[model samples]
Target: MPISTYQVKSFAFVVREGSISGAARRLGVSQSAVSQHISNLEATMGAQVLIRGRDGVALTPVGQDLFQLADEYASLDQRIEERLRGHAALDRGHLTIIANAPQPALSLIARYADGYPNVSIDFTLFDWSSAMQRLQERRVDIAVITEPAASRELYIRPITQSRYVCYARRDDDFAQRPVVHLRDVADRTLILPEPGSLTQRVVSKALADHGVVPRRLVTMTSFPVMKEAILEGVGVGLFLSASSVSERSLCEVAVPELDQVFTTCAVVPKHKLGLRVIKSFLDVLADSRA
Candidate 1:
């Protein structure tokens, strides 16, 4: 008899998650059950597919060969189930999405919920690395990420491009200007996003290129905190245009040297393209673009 497809699926999840417990959580099955599936698969193949170690499970050379095949089988099974439910009115299925920036994702979510009232969305706010990790682990069905590093496992669709701008409280002197340069704020305190963020990368590079340095720098990890700091007359801060365009009390100033336009993309597992829920969200995204 051939190895069971269910067993293959369990094995695939283990490969993706790097631990049996993680795979069990993803499949909503017992740890013993997952272990049993792997044992059965190994017995059927007459090979030890996984080598358990202190760090986590590692695929044996044989296991590596089977991994891709198992993933393809799982993808085909998902597609078949989705097709069987064909045109079921987009009334069910929950989407797990991870996003780095909230603006475009929030906009997309609002519109998607409005059109498909029955579909549920679970959104997680994460940094770019965390978001990419979730996608690679198959924990999230979709990801809205900014400046994602190149990867072959993900299918990326460019959604939006955002430019950096400066925002300051209305009473601040820089608020009177239509544009702000890094050199102009050398003496003033500058509020900026935390290190390693896309916004920070763009802003820092521009300042370096122009050889301008701020006298004081306040680094914030959260956008709301940065915004609040700016609102309270803390300091002028760099922000993406999408985030600052609607601010009532903050003046927007263009940063010409920081002209880097960051592109945010919708990312999904390469094999999950045909899933109904993924298709539904992408449809909403495309419609929004139109």
Candidate 2:
């Protein structure tokens, strides 16, 4: 028996979309049809290619090897189809983008949209960990992340560099200070993002290293919420600089111990770089740097 291209493409879409239903929607087929294609693929290969879980499908070792080639084939097929369609190549497409912070990602997205107005974009903000997870899972087209881990599978373009800062109400005592050390916030309430977030990991390490413990530690869902909590007298909030909206009632105080600068980068899978949509967005990024 020979392997079918439809089966491979279906498997690729399943991995790309992270769910059977999503692949079905992308393929304009029924869920049962997608599952049948996957089952057929496994039978032909004599191995299980996917591990279906409640969250989504994960690639087995064999599936991982197959996906790399299938993804490239899919990209090539799309390119060929676009070429045959003439000027419609760059006129339409969809991109899924994830980011940890707003600045560079939102700005870059705006610029890309101007050049490719017909292209639809789905942009979402996530904490550092979640953003990177989505990128690793091959679920998103692009990721703008802070200090993204190096991987041969990904191509990273440095966007900007920034350090962490503490946010406090204008009337708070720390707000009037030019700079505060890690130990300075020890006796005050501390507001931070929830666990599993980069902010929490970095702050936690810093606190442990310096043996600084806050009087009360509070966790918020996001940077914007942390800012609001600060205004409502919840506690001092810590996060990367320029990550949230600036407010007249809030003051950004520099923290010397947490002054390590982190680079933000736009990352895409190496194999995805050849895709027209991905390549176009990178062109926008390149133009911005020039």
Candidate 3:
């Protein structure tokens, strides 16, 4: 028997949304209906495609293979619906976006929202590792990432470039210097983002290469927290230049060892580039760059 498009679409939605109930809501069907479709899909393929867990659904090896084709089909279907709807399609839609940094992602989203107010957006901030993992899993419609790994499956466009810098309270002696060596901050209490973040990775490599180590380390979950910690005299913070709202109490200091420029890019699954919402967002990105 031939596989059904509906079954494949249901499976794709489950992967994209991360849960069957979420897929059901998107499909305007009951959760049981989505489950039955997934079951039927597995039976037809003669292999289990998904593993359900408390967190959400994960694709099995077979499911991963099937999803590429399924997602393309789903995207095409969406494109067709949008084309049939004409200009009205732009009036409302949904997009899922993830990012590692705040500047470009949040700014781009703000611009997109201004132009398409009715289009709902779900935006989340993630560390580099989690953001890349979600991008590879095809779970998000778009990701704005820093120094994204090259992949044929992804379509990437560079949005902006920046280098890492150290953040310190304005009154701190280090802030008075035009530039600080990695060694200078090594002896101070260093505040860094979570382990898998790009800032942590770059700082770790530079420290190892220069044979420097901080006297104490404080790990922060995000840029805002790191900034707050720095202001509170907890420690000096490391992050990309202009990653957060600048405060008069804080100053950015250049670290020549960490000066390697990093490019932040807008990324999307190549197969999904044609989807209306994704394309529309990319258009907004282009407008911003212009």
CA lDDT of each candidate? 0.82, 0.87, 0.90
Best-fitting candidate, measured by TM-score?
A: 3
Worst 10 residues of 3 by lDDT: 83-92
Q: For candidate 2, write residues 32-143 as lDDT tens digits.
A: 9999999999998999999999999989999988887888777677677667776344887878898876777888999999999988888888888888777777778899
As a TM-score, model 2 comes out at 0.87
Ranking by TM-score: 3, 2, 1
> What ranges in model 1 sit over 4 Å off?
1-3, 11-71, 132-139, 149-153
Give lDDT tens digits, candidate 3, residues 144-180.
Answer: 9999989999999999999888899999998999998
Predicted candidate 3: what Cα RMSD to the true structure?
Answer: 1.8
What RMSD, rounded to one decimal, does every model reach?
Answer: 4.0, 2.5, 1.8
Per-residue lDDT of model 1, residues 1-290, tens digit only:
58888899999888867789977976789999999999999999999999988887988999988987887777788678768887568866667787876778889999999988987777877766667766765656788888777789888999988888888888888888878888987998888878767777777887888888999999987567788898998888987777523678977788877777788899988888888878889999999999
Q: How many Å off is the CA of 178 in candidate 1?
A: 1.0
Compare the candidates by lDDT and give the number of the best one.
3
